[model samples]
Target: MKTKLICALTGVGLLLFTGCTNLAEKVLDEASVSGLTDKQAADGNIAPVYARLPDIFQHTTYFALQEISTDEAILPYRGGTDWGDNGIYLALHQHTSTSTDPNIRNTWLLLLQGISRSITAINTLPTINDPASKVYIAEARGMRAYYNMVMLDLFGIAFLKDDPQATSDILRGEAAANYIKAEMLAVEPDLLTTVGPGRLSKGALWGLLARLHLNYAVYRDRYADTFTHKPEDMDKVVEYCDKLINSGQYQLSKDYFPIFNSDNHSNPELIFAVDQRAELNGHNRLAYFSLSGDQFPIPAYVGANGTDGPAITPDFYQSWVSAYAGKDPTVDPRFYKQNLSIYSNPGDSCVAESAFNINRGILRGQQYGLIRVNGAFVKCPDGKYKVGKLFNTTRNKPTLPVNFTEKIDFTVAGSDYSTGYRVEKYEFSKKSVSGRNLGDADIVIVRLADIYLMRAEAKLRKSNDAAAALADVNTVRASRTVTTPPPALTSMNLDLLFRERGFEFYWEMLRRTDMIRFGKYEGTWTEKTNTDKQKRIFPIPQTAIDGASNLPGYLVQNPGY
Candidate 1:
């Protein structure tokens, strides 16, 4: 049975379904809407557009394309068998993905759903005479522009449609960029400023515009030998960034971990985020994705363990070492935060505690957590709990201690369960007691630190002002209030600023575009040695191409595949 939804307009109501990935092209049957109030109509139409976000931003979908494909993260086939998934993940990291790759195809479908849902809301919201519907319509337009921006970034093409059953107008290069920019500009005045980061407020639109302009050079000419950041584009980036910076609505977070905590709804740094409040359509896959199989974060449920997923690449870890002049990267508050108190003493063998606390940041070396015996957690003599060094529970090597190593060889012998250092940035939600599904953390889309970095990059590229760029970089560093926040940099350059961004937003999924903009996408790192420029933008999924085959030249695959 399909889940049907009523897209309530004034008199005519369209029957839509949850499984329709491309709602824009679907011809709907007309149904009469009886007694829906303005609030009910707003809720029915606008909420689905926002609901599509959690699926789009899932770890196996967009995060895989954004983070795992770059040097920031990698998911090797554990024990030469697990996570192989027909080599899809390996293909992505190696720049060998095809149109049939499920991750790529799924990402395309979900992004289209976002655009489709936004289109549904945009077309229906105007019929309501309530003043709030106008704001909802503007938000829908902003969301549509945002989804198109991501589409343009990944596939080098965006589909625009105003009517429900109209054929989408395919756009690319300057035409697509200009269309998205124009839509945002037209809806700017109608967007509200007071709405929280979950919705597209005026500030969030400004942030999106800043992001679109910051990467404007790449979107304009994705395959250039070297991207040229025009002065006007850089100026636009700076102007929009300054609006969010001076708006007095947001601030840099003092403690970096709280910004990703489950209770971070009131965190002051978020400019735009997907609201996972009350575990509404929430997921714990991100928190559980990169953890070791034996290192469970939720103690109450033995089944709530990790699946031995992706880990941080050593090449990315070297960036932090190079930035801090060979000092321990833990000195930088952004790199690590020690929350587990049992490890206060290095030699403490057994602690009688049951709290499920784990340290954050790049988890390397020996890992310690609760031990299980006979399908139950081991308890101390005092009836609390016993902590022991973790071991490989899923793989055949039960005797091997769970010591995460820095060097991963991507071979049968080397790429075991504990090859690369895992990332535990997002806090595991305490609400996930029996399983790793319920999470409440609002995933950040845009924040103030990114704004500052955009402004700094614009300053460097626009006018070669090193001093001004240095000030902006240091402002972000000093805001991390720790025992010693990452010490202020006395100097700054393009390379230094790029490294700074990696430190600040490691698992936040901004690395792929950052690498391309800095002209480092072709550089070799670890298992990836391909220097093909065609791999910059992904190939359009074959399903999408077939879906639009009725209209000639409606959807064309990218140049590579």
Candidate 2:
């Protein structure tokens, strides 16, 4: 029985279920929602804001736009025409995408949906007139500020509406930045001080503020030759970062890989995350998006292997490899060397090693691991198992090995089914839901590691405290590498900072912003050459411009498109 939520604002209420991968589960969720009290309902109302993220961060959405726009990653046309959706990914890589790009349109709509949902929750959650509901109200407002910030970052404008019936107000450039900063500050006091990864809290607020202030110069002057980084704004970033860090509530995880694993929510590292569990409308795109069809990690849940979409660029992989010119790449803590014992010694089955072994961080080089056969491991003649070639699903033959190496082209017969490095940043979800592709790992929007880096950057840029900045970087490195931490820099500089950030937080929807702030957005990277400053902010999707009846004259496109 399909049931629709009816309210005075029927359309607005219905949007809560938008992009739901599973209808049966979503209907059941809505069914149970009726039993909750007004306060409970209000508290639960902000969930839609979180639900809208996977659509934004999915394999080929905003996250791809962010990473692929730089030297980090790219979505090359597989076998010439498979991923070639009118050359959108190619255009994005070449810095030639226009307003009509599907990703730009989809990302814009999803972000706006987040803003609308937050406003709906803020208006509805306040009805209980109870003091306890204020936290939820604050969370909703914080989320609204967050969604607006992201929209502003991408489109250079943010849409604001206090209530469902109100006219949408457009905040552009610095005005949008200020409004969002003020909103976060306003809600900071009322938010829950306790640690809550998915829900908004004071820690998340501080993290957001630190991020906004650190990038305030760019928001203030996007096209300037030299971005004006106000010391005052930098101080705000420091203040909030300190408050969150000093809280003693959160800490960076010991191992970097686990933080991106399926059960990452349990770690103290995540400050704010989109709760993307199998039970939720989460996606498995992040996990299996790049995996070969034959490399079945979890055979039961994902009957097939992977969709074979995006992959890491040779440039990004080289950045890490080049750094350790002579030394072992695996020793760099960040360069997670996986269970190569399986293929290194033939006839040895690494099926004994968990599926989650090399699934985290950058997957590169001669991939020595198990080959799935008959939905299980391939057995050796001695009854023990043998690692074999991962047959391409299209051919389903044992001809091609699962040896993931950095060699391939943009088109047909040239670019092998596997080209460039693959990253399973989010762990795969084993529990299958019909008509859905949900991953278990909660996609962390903000984590403790980000805070440390933010603080370090602010210190370096604002106060020129290299010692302090280097200290912050060392702390994270020390924790992750128990055997031998990364050698701390004798000095600090922007180039070092850029590489450090790439190492600490690659593939986390942060590369673009980091590149912009460091003025590297215009530099040559892989397929794209250094180009226009306007490319810093994407073109406002033309569809959004066409439907701006509410903000008729207010919705202006970014300079480029």
Candidate 3:
């Protein structure tokens, strides 16, 4: 028998977990597992914890907080109407976000729910007598640590709790970092190496360890002008990265796009990711969010269209242009991948017999997608789709060509619908023929390329062998096996490594942390000008603070909020 968790959602859309500690206890309605075996019960108890990842990492929540806060991406109000969201995104990009901001509040709630779920699993899984129960318990602990790591990174505090009914011991800074590290270390041995990237595995644990150690200094002193990367932490980063590299369980993806393709669950490069198969309520927002409103990837269902959301900053795009010198950024395999050739010629139209595909990577100038004819997709004679140059379809800008400009001028009146260069790195899922909700792509949390780069950063910071670090970066650069791969760097430094990270991992929601680590988070880009160090971590949601107000110092807001 499989145990089922039926959670009651409150009026405010928060999960009212029943019999749970540290919050309002409405209690979760759980199905009894009286006749279930220990292994079955253990598996069932941990499922909901894993299920919380999709919502926590959604585009409008954590992804918005991470990417919109950085220079890599921006979400301006389109035509003073769409995505206005009462200037929540504008505040996020401008680094003036508050505790009441929806994104912050939603992220905090989801992350805490994930932690709570993990704690619930940890509490229940131990009672089972089977040996698998121990492993499940270890997984629960590891997951709790991962959630806390995100919590600490975002709000500068990690809620540590063993019992569901007890108050959480809020650890900040070094204490939080140490607790996360210790949890992963303690559970590392029990984690299975052969498990898939979606679960808590030895490889995932190692990757998490490397990430924790690499960013350990940032956690130690988040607002410091320059982080003091301790030699020991650097050693740990290198060690874990090396372990991952030598393990041979993962490899660098030769084709960069497949790493984020809808059917990427078995991709070896993924050490850990959110398993977002089409069957689940996964979202294709990452692909759809940054596209032009006129650009519709799916043809079968005319409803499946882009939201014309965020786009890459010109400063970020210029970084790629500068890195390549005279050569166009598109020449680099990682920069762009052209999948559709319908509009290759000026006055040409091609029949997309199977799937109406679009180009991937940083899109600039004119865009192309399915054209609409009286509220329906224009189709060829044979019932195939005909592609054409895209025009603005939303915000009453139908005649405007969907030409993405480099510079965005957002003002009190409005911003252009197609201002910033859009990024379409993740492929539009074939499964999402009808709408944007059903995305199958596993949201990549950790991959081998990141590991290589982490190792390189660790080695460089340690000042042991700059040559080895350069080699590692070159190794990653060489992974792009295009007609002419990105030229290997002649030399490597922190600046170059930082740029390389942007080239490899842009629009993947890692930019904010990267910018902070590189000490460029305070630098101005486009509309963002604020440089206050306290803005490093987002303010604790006012609701969270207020809810715990009775406890006095329980949920303190981050400084400089």
Candidate 4:
């Protein structure tokens, strides 16, 4: 009876059943039965589905999920920070029992529901009447599949359903992977053949496929009693990576910064990205997290303290600094720009100024210009300044500078640190300031450099010492800082490749996945030392477990929940 109902509704083009508001109103009206053709219903429904993409790909959720899951980024709240509540989850998954604050849970449910709703709308589109409709549906499905992959990685289960109105069908382990694979395969042929460079193309399908298979070893064992990586799984990864690389559809961008700039949407390197409009979806967090005390002078946002800075983990900074020792300072500009101190300058340009190097301690008014012999504080011709102390004393008693470092701590205040190797992946503007909701940079989800690293890992796994794999990895590293090529490979393994990935793609949300693939997911860090079992998947949202009744056994919660 259920299957019969679905078939009949699909045949009659029950657009309202598919949950497309525009089409439902146009065809059936509020009565749910009115005078309208199936064709009109289908056309009207498609636009609303596209409109949902911006909301579905929202950053409020993705940024939290991405940073918390990786080592490259941490959510250390300083004073006067608004994004602190979510940051606490990033630091520790524990949340207050109060159900009123639903950001995390709401984000999870909305992404799942949004993806499901979008897929339902795409499935309802009338067949092939308009070429544009086909493209739109293809994009929608790809996005749906991508979102599903994220869910599987983070939650270890997906809400599987054939019909739009059906209840959520939870699938775990291999069952989940198989379902995701089937969806990708079903949509592969319909996607655009060549979607320019950065946009989603059939080639991008191969990239996503590579990602799925590369992590198959983990996904397949996420909810199982024991975990093991099969040789065949590695073969599948190599297969998809080869398709993406050999297809000649994409290439690494010459300049790494261009990949993250506001003008980066059309860059050839990006395989897929969530488009962020300045006025609509622009991220103020980057500026909010990275702005130093000087740029955001105190008594403005906070009473005596100024801007709270985002602090990089001490270990992460050491790793980069060690890698670049004795090498040309200009070798990889990204290392310095994305992961170094901001300098103090009185001029307008930030990057062009000399960096402010000071002791890593609290800055007070006495220390402002105490040791300078020339009486002129070493100010950069450019406006860049080291993110240290925020001086907020009035000119009458300017000598008594209050130590505003408390504003940068994670617990007391909500201030996000923009100090100590701040991320410069996206270009920072002089006009942009923290506390002001303004930024116009597009975030990169999948880029060509990532593909090269993926291909390298796959090839190393398949054929240990393959020169082609080594060359592919080296090509990407070479592009950063424009230095001598990396050493030729005599031997290769997942560990070496994973470390390379860590260095190549830090804070881009691939850290946790990379860690899992290399068997480092459960390794201890400053605050977390989760076991392998806990590492595979996050505890099912406590709310979900409490909500389920009928399928108590069917929905066995992941261990350690």
Candidate 5:
């Protein structure tokens, strides 16, 4: 008798099970088997797949990959020292880990499992006659394609199976790209035509295609050690981007914060976002990572409020301040919120006052004060380096001191000094904060602002003069803060455009791709310097290499592995 593995899909009555005697084989089979008319079959397959999304969404995997790939620095912690292990795999080239690190391997397996199950559902859903069901199935396919793209980007390979019941075979190089493109195109027609903003639409599918094709030069020849965008590929990028931008269904958000707000799932600026429900799968740790250390004002942190930490690096902060110099610092809220001190002036009645007083010689033990103001070093009244100000609003009169040991409770609303520039992207409801839940900010995968930038880059690559491209870029810039536009396209070059992109999309998860596209991926940094070979792809996970001994030469590890 065959053993039956039962699975359940809660909230959406779907159960799925597979008949296999071997538990490992059965779990793998159940993970990819989904053709249930009732809850039983659906739950068997769908639940396991859904279970992997939260794991993929974990900070160690998705968040870490996104941050390390970009210019952002990883927070120092154990098990993160070896660039080869995690940092270098992201910073340098494609990497495979043999270490018994569960975080790394679990991330890899979970992402692949997610793709496997999602594809299985997409391939098996023809039996379900409902159009709405088909649309959701298409969404699963699109998401699977997305996961494949990340795998292809990071690992330089993907698991492709033609038959749902067949053991997956890893495809590398151009073969992987071809498979992904075919899958995305197959599901394009079935996706929802007119979903609200931030939801997946046909346009986003094309955008994802554009993204994949834009990197074709790298994927087509991973071990070549040198890459340049082919003209034909650039044409395809232009073609797809034009279709999405001219689709007339999406537009840039008037304000930047709304794009990342908890209520921004339907914002018009978003093309696609990973839905993060604080109640269901709350792991938006970007807020916590980006907050300043002293910003913890909640009663739990001994401060009047929650812990506010994660300041912009001095170098990165200077880049933004330089870009919008001479403009009202308060105008573009994105700049202020992302770069400025969180605290307001002492006399100002703003609910969250500045924690550090620049005038007095008070420095909070936790907060790092402004080391430089308008390009000059800040000094205290006592002629010493004024690190930052600590504010005590709980007292009848707000007190400013270099260092204070007074303990204050943050139970009351005004009692907590919500001072300091914490990331304003994630909305902090009283419930979300007090409950210690992940912020429900939509993880925008693609946005209209990105389209503008892509078009600008493509046009710049084609026509040396990017006046039109600059106009498109400036349109997004204008929305951030009220400012007179810069001189009309006097100079538009790759460096300027690249820097603009860095400033605009700092932690939005496209930094590594953007850097590679502009030929800066292998350049040296303060902490990392990668070789040209490292620029092409990451090494296959050592486990994958160890598992597939039969497939000799078929699965060669990336160079330097």
Candidate 6:
């Protein structure tokens, strides 16, 4: 049975959801909202609000603006041809991007879409007439605040409107931070604290609140050298982290890969994540974006090729090597995960035969995968797959037997594309040949480990207690599968904490924010030699301003742009 509830919202607005095809003829009228239970319509309204998040995380979009612009990753033109969007990427890496950057514009539009839909849901949900309706309304408001928080983080100003036709108001700095914190805190009592890692549970709310307070000083004064950290704010951060820890619903996982694997929806570490599935709205960019075109993790599956994008900076790669130089690096579980065939596919069985079956955390040595001869996989008479060297069409040469160097000098020709080590943190989906297609891994947003890390940083910053901070970090190191950990730190400081965060969350899209707060964003690194404090917050896209024809001067571009 399908229920169709169509609320004719006035003015320019967004449809609440792309799914829920059931909302049809029967529930199309305004009066019909009374006929269905609140839970039923709640699912219908809340979907589109959550839908906006996938855009920010999608590869080649807003996520590109965050990670590629930092010292952690780069999307240099491959072989002097590929990913050459007329210097758009180069501009981003150098902090020379203007308001006309497409990514900046798209992010603004996508976030506003969420804000609009949430308002619509809040306005329409009450008429459902079930007590459960109020709960959904609260959820809608929580989601709205979360979306605004993201906007404020990226653009320095969040657009606010109670109705679709209302003039958009701006909130920035501390005001925006307080708005996000208060909204989440007010409604969290009714949020599903016990029900989900996918849905906005109380744990998720607390994790976000903890992040807001922990970074409160940064948001309050982004360009300041000695950031003013309020004890009250840091105390609130500790309080929220404790809330999640005491809830007893989440824990740090022993094996790091499982927490980020294809089936991570059930992972205990995931406080909140996008419920991405292959059958639903799932994109595999996370799994294979950094992979070279020739390295096929799944031979039987074919659709789109790897983008070969956003390789880790040589600087970031060396950070690990230098940090654990004296100790055995293998003991740090987060640094590496070897590829082992647990699938029945004949292609996977061939993975055992590849020249380099080693799927190290940072892919630096000779790359290995399936070889195609005459449109058929080359296999030995014994029926095992035959692994061979890689050849790139761009360079038109078989170099070093396909060895990927750990160093990337972006200024050099052809050297930029292939030099840097590829990121291999997220595992390729190794399901059956029949089931394989796009990636199905949930994109983790807030995890339990990050909560602990936040608490430790809050404590370190608040009271300068290095011993207590070290203990919190050690707890994460102890839980990983890699048993060979670096010796317990004799002391802890801000510099050490920042380095640890880079190692822990590489390629997870927190680098820009981390760099800003650490006062390292303006520093020279590889291609990013220019330093501009205004570049910390991205410009409000000029396209957004021009599109708001109805309200003149409604969207002022960010300071520099």
Any idea what lDDT model 3 has? 0.82
For model 6, residues 120-143, the per-residue Cα lDDT tens digits are 888888776566667778878888
lDDT of 2 by residue, 1-561 (tens): 245442222232323212322322233255686677776665566566577777777777877788878778777777666677998888887788898998887787678777877887787776665566778778888888998899878878866678576656777879989999989889988988674687788888889999999999999988987787999988988898898889899987877778877788778989988776645765547777777655665533336456667777777787877767787666676766454455465544534434334445677655544455555666555554455455564445467655566754465543566777777666566665421267667787888878888888888898789899888888788887544666665667778888889988888889999999998888886677858998989988776565453444655778877
Query: Which candidate order results from sorting by TM-score in descending order?
Result: 1, 3, 2, 6, 4, 5
List where candidate 3 sits over 4 angstroms from the true fold: 1-31, 35-37, 129-131, 346-348, 412-414
Q: Give me the overall lDDT of model 6.
A: 0.72
RMSD of 4: 8.4
**Candidate 2: where are CA atoms >4 Å away?**
1-36, 129-131, 350-359, 373-386, 393-397, 408-414, 433-436, 481-483, 549-552
lDDT of 4 by residue, 109-171 (tens): 555645655666676664435556676676667666776787788778765665665555677
TM-score of each: 0.94, 0.89, 0.93, 0.73, 0.72, 0.88
- lDDT (Cα) of model 1: 0.82
Q: How big is the positional error of residue 393 in model 1, measured in Å on the Cα after superposition?
A: 2.3
**Model 5 / residue 237 / CA error / Å:** 1.8
Per-prediction backbone clash count: 0, 1, 4, 27, 48, 4
Model 6 regions more than 4 Å off? 1-38, 302-305, 340-360, 393-400, 414-416, 430-438, 482-487
lDDT of 5: 0.54
Q: How much does candidate 5 score in TM-score?
A: 0.72
1 against 2, candidate with superior TM-score: 1
**Per-residue lDDT of model 3, residues 381-484, tens digit only:** 76767788788765566788999888874764326787889888877777765557667888889999999999999999988577998999999888877446
Q: What is residue 84's positional error in candidate 2, in angstroms?
A: 1.2
The per-residue C-alpha lDDT of model 3 at residue 167 equals 68
Q: How close is candidate 4 to the true structure, as a TM-score?
A: 0.73
Q: Write the per-residue lDDT of candidate 1 for residues 133-185, one digit (tens) a residue.
A: 98999999889999999989998987778887765677899899999999999
Q: Model 6: C-alpha RMSD to truth? A: 4.8
